[model samples]
Target: MKRLIAYIMLALSLAACKKQNVKDTGPTTVVTPPVTGIIDTSRTSWWQKAKFGMFIHWGVYSVPAGIYNGVDISDPGSGHYGSGEWIMHNLQIPVASYKEFAKQFNPTAYNPEEWVQLAKDAGMKYIVFTAKHHDGFAMYDTKYSDWNVVKATPYGKDVLRPLVDACRKYGLKIGIYYSQANDWINKGAANGGFWDVAQNGSMDDYIDKIAIPQVRELLSNYGDVLEIWWDIPDEMTTARAAKFSPVLALQPRTLTNNRLNQNWTGGDFDTPEQNITASSGGRPWESCMTMNDSWGYTKNDKNFKSSSTIIRNLIKVASLGGNYLLNVGPDANGKIPQPEISILKDLAGWMRINSESIYDTYASPFKFTPWGNATTKLTADGNTNIYLHIFNWPGGEKLHVPGVKNQLLSASMLANGKSVNGINDDTGITLDIPVGPVDNISSVIKMVVKGKLQVEVYEQGPEANGSFILSAAAADLHNPNGWDDIHVENEGNPNLGYWTNPWAYATWKIAVKTPGIYKVQAEIATEAGATVMVASVNGEAVQKTLTSTGGYGSYRLVTLGNLKIANSGSVTFTLAPDPGNWQPVNVRKVILTP
Candidate 1:
């Protein structure tokens, strides 16, 4: 018996040796495909290349920084010093009461070159500063109104001009954030009437006389403005939007946010506040998020998101073919808080190593994995490169991709030039992921493929039965329903969110106010023969499961059991394969209805 055992051990050792020899033989060598087309050089593409930018929310609000007359005037509802400097407008503080802030608003140490240089050092390609905030105070020297930094304060300097000049000196693009709506001094605007008791005048005349001319001055004086970041155009009419459209005629290339008019006709791109949309694939979109809680400088605001979170957020936005406009509010003394500076420097270090994956890259063609997120961009040679952004590294050293038909040429870590080994099969692509926390922030994996991008989609159920219609291949589930096509979020982390094909997943969290027999359906396509899906309610596993049989598959009207959700309770739906091997599954819609 001992001899027999020894023989078996010898056989096992020989087998292991044989396998090692096969691996040592090395991967197959194949010629790469020829280049197809040049990159689209439209205005949209230029903006997309600018994956990361800086947003500065500075103005009269910096003077207050959440304090008025030695009293903490922070708003309790939204928090953070009553939206920075807008507290005066929001609280309806009388002009006489608020005018006192202008006296101490003298920023003696303010240097536009220092600020713009800091942004350039951080690898930011663009800078967007607040020219006029909701408080009706213009940061630039404007001919239209007396309520401006150049006219109202003791330090009567045109802040915007110097900043613009500094940006040009550093070879960075410059933009302006104008709050055309909710101006406190422009009586023609409806919200401006809040300060009516201070000045007696006609509102319409105030808008025509004060607001329009100020806008013209901003467009004419600023040299080669790249964008106009408009905000909160609530209750604005088409006529008002039409009035603003001509201003852009002055600079046809100037990109504007959707907020220029509530109708969204004037803006060049859809601006989603604080979030990225899933459906922004092959479209223009920007995510404007504040560093802390408010856009303007706020004192005693400690709720700033960690640098890791901010970096992850930027990666997600970039992965989905969207730009991230990160904001920073300087204190009343015109100094960026120490914490913000540290965060920016750290982010710049990270960008220095992994910028190739972000800068000048378009969206990826692969679907977002349940455990991670991916973005694809075509190289100059026309070969598509997919970047896998791992937010939460799995415990194991292997990543299992369900469906991929194209042969992989190479795989490497974006941070360090380390080669990764894996297997490619019809079942899926399984790569050896590095073990033990790779980075403090997210890590990117670049996968070079040989052929045109292809993907298979799977649906939870049928559309006719109960599934919501999936519009774009990519949609952001976290944003409001109509906003999915406008912004892109969930960029780098695959496990956190979902999008359509070539777009990240936009899953919906539907609340059942009234419970009844509801139909749940989804539209999906997959490359494999069969795929499985599971649904659950409040952590309780549901018995029903949907299956797809063939390529480019879908399901409709998969009825869920009668649900009785209490008013306070919530329901969640998730999708995955049964055998757990599926790739590039495009989920178009998930509809729930009685």
Candidate 2:
């Protein structure tokens, strides 16, 4: 009986060993990766397909075109005392200024079809026309206000109506930019209106009599508004916004921006003006920037961003999982400036070739590095693809990437459809970029992973050479609060001192979980008497130093070599001041690309 039992136990043990060996030989099972963050995928529904769009800033402001009373009136700096868009109001030019403009605003060559055709040729998928600017003059016909294009102009036409119709006919989505803060016309309505003139009128009465009624007219007149770009409602309170939320019911799916109220009570998305933020995981965001320095038509404003600059900005925004709405200011004749049109066409051409990296894409699992930007998208089968945008290629055939550990399926350039080789290791992935510089603009490399990509970032201190930190102050500067934090001193003020003569100093302690090459960058300003500024790691002086002059400075990227850190390693950063008391320093942002 004992011998029989021993035989049975031996058989059972053999069987278990065989099962374990079989499991080791078979393919490994992969668990489904977690979604990074919840994004209203619906917000991407429209913008993803419509990869590129045009913003037309045409309004009564265009009529003045930065002039008043036969004189070129500039904004506050140029000896004008009003918002550039409010020149007529600041100079109190009265109805005469507008009347004269009306006579010359005939726009005899204005053809809606021609405009739409030009946009289509340029590859714009949508158009956002200014229905009303700060001037309070409506471009569309509205029963609620007599100060509209149909009633106030010699042309006596609803300018926006034909544009909308033409856009729809040409397969373009239509968006409207509405000035919720009325300037000249509806001043008595709701919280003193645009010019902030407090009249003895009830807020509700003004909203009911003018604001809401005009909004209702717009929704009813337009076929279907995809977005409502509201601007400059500084006086609007949360209660006021709640009262106005019902207006959105007229067009339920329409997207709204955060500018309508101080608190952004009913905004569908956060609007970052002229700047893009690092990804908030999966938060929805849009960057609205003007073609020129000014939002409205300014004849003397020659500060237009170049075509390449605009395209780069768009890509940067997209890489951070945000949309870009580039603006254009038309002349008084209702014609887009030739220069602006040229830039848009160039952007459109680029989008046609490389938009796959942008449209329908999400923020990459890897953080943005000094080498360039990065973005990611998911395939239909749930496989994930990452795109690396290299604006300043390292000029080498091979490039190393850290913090990625997934199996790579393929690597290729999205522009030319050329395949590239890559090496995958436990630390990260490395790809062989094209041997030579292909173009002056940025190039994208696509990396397909078997499943979702996972990565975490750690910072090491100055003592641990090559470690970095993105200070709280730098993060706060990019907050939606406002551009008030854009000053030179505020750039890296709270964390790293400005690169000025009087060197202000700050100490940063960073902890790193792994050892790797890390890159550091800071936004610094230069003023008179400013000399070279230095940064040191762990009391060891860094070789790279930045020199500045008296002006708005550019971002200086500092490459700290590979750092070796075990678990719980820490490092510190120190800044040395230049000789001078000049407070001509600012440090806006600091990036630690590990």
Candidate 3:
């Protein structure tokens, strides 16, 4: 009872802290006055607190449903496909033929209340629905264009109005996604290239006349547009992007993504699409990914990620201090597919049990952990609350948290509130966990630390045998070319793979106690020809030629000559690719033998 009270008090204090310096509108209502003067990061408090949101991608594309002329738009074998939403662009379908889809665009079964309720049940705090997709067909009643749901479709009503009302009724924030650029049906808008003669109009006129007016209606008609999602700023120059500023100024508190302009002017947060990017520079970011392969509904794209995958993805994003905007593509009938609904139901179950570990938690202090991820929250009494989301539970019932120097207060299972004990050592704290996991997907353990948190730097030290084993899992990846380009792959064993970028490298911090001459051996796998790799430590470096091992899955251990270490307490070992003669390889581990 006391612990629960402490948690409640901590949550209230954190809520107060999030709203401290931000502009106060009336009584914390959803709608606020238009943003005036300088807009700071405090405007993003609601969104930052909302760690998860639902992304809806519905449009005329659902009418065709990734199929055109009896061929799948994304059929790789036919060599004629892109995203389901870009079917018109990829097929270069004439406007006359594409406009025919609007005749069949009637979502008779779309219940706004049901949709909003699902999101709320799934623990999503907000919803970003597609008002207008790249197809240039609006899903709402737009006076600016006749190519809208009200005028063109059989169901002649504004879809967004009811959705907004439902959100307000259910206490879920509403957002609008408008394709600012690359409007396929609109004249004079950027359409990637001039595929059709009708698309050869001035881009500025489209922004000024159609785009800006539609944006104004979206912001005004909607009670409080909490988020304005701008997609594919292909030709959105600074001047053209600047034109939408005044319209957005009306809803000053609305959070805008980075896709508004090429320069990212007025963008409140970064939007990383389709992948979870590394974070911790303090800038707010959200990763928008689809449950399946396609953002829009594709009839054949049944490759939905499992409920476990979705839960883990959400946990991973929270651990990195970012939000996850999961996409759901409803069919033409306005019904979220049964599989998608099932996934959400499963997610709702998990969130019911383990959401406290996710909501309002900051990034983990530890760089990386093999078992799973961690999220932290500061308590009201200047202590720290750490949630250990264990994905891979230890078989021996011992969970080691390395490099933590903070004094442990209490540990408990998040699911059942059962007590868990911990022991602090020279390495870190180790918790004695239950024999079986509390939850099959992810079992969270809530831990409280006394006073301010403290952690030791993570460095691999020599074992009792006086030999150092630098595993790939412990290496800190340094890649300027984003997260997906070069990263740690977990096929069978976790190894640093997909190393195509020459500029990317991996570093492992080492603490050498008994320093002396050591023989180096590296476990690597490569399908390509011999590549030069430089392994450097303590100002001494050695170049090793990595020969092909027949296939990327095939692993081989090659010995690189010895190097003398005069004296060392802490040193960094960097394994970098030779840009001049580099071949893609997977590094499993590096071993030093005394």
TM-score of each: 0.73, 0.75, 0.84
Model 3 lDDT per residue over 1-594, tens place: 233223333433443333211111111112111111112356886677678999999999998988898879767775776678878877788888999998998899999999999999999999999999988988888889999999999999889899999999999999899999879888988457777887778888899889999999998887888888898788889888888889989988898887887654347766767666543234577889899888898888888888998888899888877889999999999999999999999999999988888887777766557788888887899998889998888889899886666789999999999999998876668999999898878899999988666665555668779888888766666544333445665623878888887767777666777778888888989987789777766556677788889898899998876867777775656677777778998889989887
lDDT of 2 by residue, 1-594 (tens): 233223333433442232111010112222232232225456646764454567777776777788776566654465664335666666655454454565556565678887787777666678888887766678888887777778877778888888999999999889888877545555453233233333334655666677777778778789898888887676677776676677879988787876788655346666656655432324455677788777777887777877777777777767655677777777777777888878867866776777778776765444335466677778888788888877778867887665565788999888887998998864467888877645457788888988666543323233344334455332211122331123112211332332222423433335554455455555555553424444444323433344453465444444433332323454434433332324444554455556
Better of 2 and 3 by lDDT: 3
Tens digits of per-residue lDDT for model 1, 1-594: 233223333433442232110010112212222111112556656777877899998877777687665555554644424567666766566777777787778888888888887787777899988888877788888888888888899988888898999999989999988887667664545463455565555545655677677878988988788898887776566776677767778988788777776665445666767766532223467778887777788786667888888887777777666788899998777888888898898888878877777777755433335455566677777566877778778879988654455677888888787998877875446889788546757688888877665433322222444333323322323222234332332334122223222212233223334454445555544453433344333333232343453544343335434443333322334332222323344454445555
TM-score ranking from best candidate downward:
3, 2, 1
Q: Which of 1 and 3 is the better model by lDDT?
A: 3
- Measured on C-alpha atoms, candidate 2 has an lDDT of 0.61
Better of 1 and 3 by TM-score: 3
Runs of candidate 2 with Cα error greater than 4 angstroms are 1-38, 41-44, 48-51, 70-77, 81-84, 90-92, 121-123, 189-204, 278-282, 458-509, 512-567, 570-585, 588-594
In order, the Cα lDDT scores of the candidates are 0.62, 0.61, 0.79
